[model samples]
Target: MLHEIGHNLNLDHANSEKGKEYGDLSGAMGHLYASETHPMMCFNAANTFDDLEWYIDRQKIIYKSSYFWEGDLVGVAEYDLCRTGKYVAIKIPKGTYSSRGRYDYYISFNRKILFNSGTMEGGDQVLVHKRYTKSPSKSYLMKKLRSGESYSFQSMTVHVQSISTNTSPGIATVRVTKETPAPVKPVTKHPTSNPTPVPTPGLTPGSTPDPTLNRTLGPTLVPTLGLTLETMLEPTLRPTLGPMERLVEHPMKKPLECSPQQLLKPSVTLQGPLSGKIKHSKSSKAKRPLQHPAYPWNKHSKTSKTKSSLNHPVNFGLENPVWHPVKCNDMLERSCINNPLFFLKVKGRRRNCAWLGRKKWRANRYCKKSNKSRKMVCRECCNSCRICTECSKICSNIKY
Candidate 1:
């Protein structure tokens, strides 16, 4: 069922050099067996996620040919398996130019635990797979490396410095090195003959010539007309009217709608200069409720007997100031969500509020005053229910 799901996700079988089909044992797409007791199998290969457009979601470190040109020995990069905070895999393009590269290599650290327990063979090793750029579903397993092992191809070498497979989520440090690329020769274009300069138009006789127009116009290039000070000095198309002659103006032309009295006294509907005087009557002012300074920020009001926590605002410092009552909805849209790969269980098989914000009933149990991680991750969710709400107090001594 798992292997077929990979097929549904546009992932082909993981192939190997022995000519036997489904030979790669590191991924579930390869030859595998499932029993009733151990129904869950291994996760799909990193290449499968790449094909599904989860490149950023899976956190893949892509190294191009230009990376080698930047410096020698492009340092040992660490990859944490199934962790959102760190990279899960590394990808390298086949050719010098990444855009034109026909093939791409993906390296990932695989382990035997949870879903990956089905494949017992070569479970604790870094697996490398090559995929054709044009056909993403076609993936070929190239090599498997243990600690200190290295793989070489097309003048580029990937060396595994160290790997820890015993941990919950394994960590692998790998370094990429390449041969110094040959310096490219600069191309120079020369004209057959000297080009003539085009004279700028609409310029005064004594005015300085336009700097751009002074440049030599090439035979193949077209010159644009230039407008200078001479264009502005031309006579006006229409004459202006005098204050005394304004009485004999055209009847079709509309007069100003705003009177001088309306400008001086603004109305209640418009408290600005455009309308008349805006003043609240005694009866209307008496009906308006008076709010205490502390009651707006704090949920527990001393004067009111009502249990509603609607007016309470969450303060996130001067930068964000206050999260308004209506706009306090979760700012973490699917696009900006930095959710973890696996739903890590806390306590007794329960997930944290940060991971379960969308599922309100399941998240309510974890949204406690003691859960400090909840405030940092799901602030909007916590603020909505007036649970464990507090103002952000940044230290003046510290620079963030």
Candidate 2:
């Protein structure tokens, strides 16, 4: 019986702080290790590279995905491929672009990483060549697969939409990322370095064992690693299960059961098109929650009177610091801008870690303090940014 090793190997979930998730790779697991694409010691996925052979012939990856809201169909892990990682090219289905070749396609290696993060980098991946746009896998690009390394297409996800084998096209138009099969005869002999010597019960002296089972999937390709050429090219369908899905007792607070009223009579409730989009905002001073466009700061201090002098702030009566009016999309606070935790700004939403205000130069600390870090939740938008409860604590305790 062929045994799977890595799945039970105990690597921590992507956002976790400690345990096997942070273990070194060399002999940690098996498969193989050649390059240091990034260091795993740091919190950022950019700092993670879980590449070690860890004693295995091969294994397939499956992800269970879901769509959080409408128009967010990332259910298929192939979606991640459209962004890093080695992949066989796929045709852009008819619909996405009005003009052919005008758009681009790629498989993202680290979706949560800011490929284009640093100042030097307007962002990562922004400048990289569109690896997946071209159709029919080319031989030159075949080197990546031939190297015996299986690059990841997506990590597990909790908030965004994901595709499933059962997903309908009404929500999204996703094609499966399929593998191309190798032309050579498949190898069965389990050639490995850690020769614990599984007693091949029926092997001839010089005869090799057959290649690992196909475990073929149906349509969408699951991002694979350390796979054989046959595994790479075979048109494997993804598990109807989203390759990377997490189930939570989604807060009952979500209005999943309550939607806007339409069938009710006018007497049931008075309804009219609300003139504007109401939102939530916080005051610089300690104050209770208030409506958006707060009468105090949103009335357009003199600077908001007209588009002229767009950068200047209009004077207001309250002595509150004249917060420079920033476009809703840009709201990194002064503390965030200056804090060593600047990674919070550089990294976008849903990422596991944020650069909290660290005190010293390059030194950093565990963002969570006591024991409750894993269950933390953070929102992505500026108006609804989520931060760890411990962030406030660690930010204050660490030396820097």
Candidate 3:
């Protein structure tokens, strides 16, 4: 019953984790699950007494003595308080022994409560609801009440007669009285007359009329004679090409041919007695300047010939070093020759030709003779595999 009364007072459940679980035993609108004491709205089984009835009776007395009475006088009671468009005043006294839900009572008055109490402390003030129909619950803290203050609402005037703070439960005596309507003065009616119609002069026949007034309302035709001639005589805007266009239009000039005599050759004048002996000194040095001992192509000394020299011989000329085989190993003997040109062609086949031996020679021969056969043979022989001294001899025996 108390819980229902709390709902009537517009009281909501006190929200908390414990309130949601065990019950909000502290507030009047709390639930009674597993709680020993029964607050106003709690559902405890121990609350079997007629205490709620007594509480309702006391509430009725308080309502009759306080702002609820003013609300009743303004045709706003507890049941019809939430009804739209109804306005009433509710007076709440300080230190009143009511339920813990004061917010519920404030909400019940809706916007009727005048929260503005100028120059008065909020704790010491009284709450008086007036003729406002909207809910001030959203912003009720902005206004407060003071003692001996009178607020007029529509035809009713709510006056705070006296506030007795000396009493145990402070009594704020408020009086609600209907305001008397002011007498209105009589308004006198005057007589109105219609004036005579003024005459407008009509256009006389065969008389010149004003051009401004006689002008046609349609759009005026503009003379295109001068405009068309000016547009036709206007110069055409020709697009200009950028520097890149000139660069692309003309082809670049060929580099000038440089003769052997005019070319900047490094001075190779021999300072020693062996000067005229090296005829092609420039070509020889330029072709193979850094001669490694392992490169048989560069090392042309007869005594320094490699072990493969037994199977293939190299010819050293004054101008260029060449390869010539006196006796070829395996089936390659028939294909072997002492051609100086062929020797020159296959001279620097590979940088590591001395170490690679016959495998390198076969790959170089295939590359020169048959371009198609060179692809497979060169790929197999000249790959990542290193020709060891033992493998070089074994490869020399294999016919390509």
The best candidate by lDDT is: 1
Q: After best superposition, candidate 1 residue 204: deviation in angstroms?
A: 99
For 1-400, candidate 3 gives per-residue lDDT tens digits of: 5545655644444333322432333223344334543322221111111212211222222332343334221111122333332223243322232333232122112111222111112333443321112222111222334566665433334555555445333345555554533557878586666776877877786978576866568755976545577778999886542211211010113222322222112343323322211222232323322221112223443433344223443222212122233321211111111121222123333221322122334443222222322211221121111122322211212222
Model 3 C-alpha lDDT versus the unseen true structure: 0.30
* Pairs of residues at least 3 apart in sequence or in different chains that clash in candidate 3: 67-91, 89-129, 112-130, 115-143, 115-144, 116-143, 116-144, 117-144
Selected candidate, larger TM-score, 2 vs 3: 3
Question: lDDT of each model, Cα atoms only?
Answer: 0.45, 0.25, 0.30
Each prediction's RMSD over C-alphas, in Å, is 31.2, 40.9, 27.3
lDDT of 1 by residue, 1-400 (tens): 6677777777777777454578776666776456435344554354444766553565454455255421111101222224454455567766643455676777766655555555644566777777776654557778888888887766667777887755545666776667533547977697567665765686577977587856786675555468646777886676332212221111124332322222111213422221222332233323222221112212232433433343444332222322334211211111111222213222234233332332222333222224433232322221111222122211111110
Q: Would you estimate the TM-scores of all the predictions?
A: 0.38, 0.16, 0.19
Runs in model 3 with CA error above 4 Å?
1-10, 13-55, 58-122, 128-143, 151-156, 180-400
lDDT of 1 at 356: 38
Show model 1 residue runs off by greater than 4 Å: 32-39, 43-46, 61-85, 96-101, 180-400
Candidate 3 lDDT at 183 equals: 51
Candidate 2 — worst ten consecutive residues by lDDT sum?
Answer: 138-147
- For candidate 2, the per-residue lDDT at 366 reads 29
- Backbone clashes in each candidate structure, one number apiece? 6, 65, 8
Which scores higher on TM-score, 1 or 3? 1
Tens digit per residue, CA lDDT, model 2, 99-197 = 333323222121212221211111111111112222311101111111122322222111112322333211222223323233378897887678666
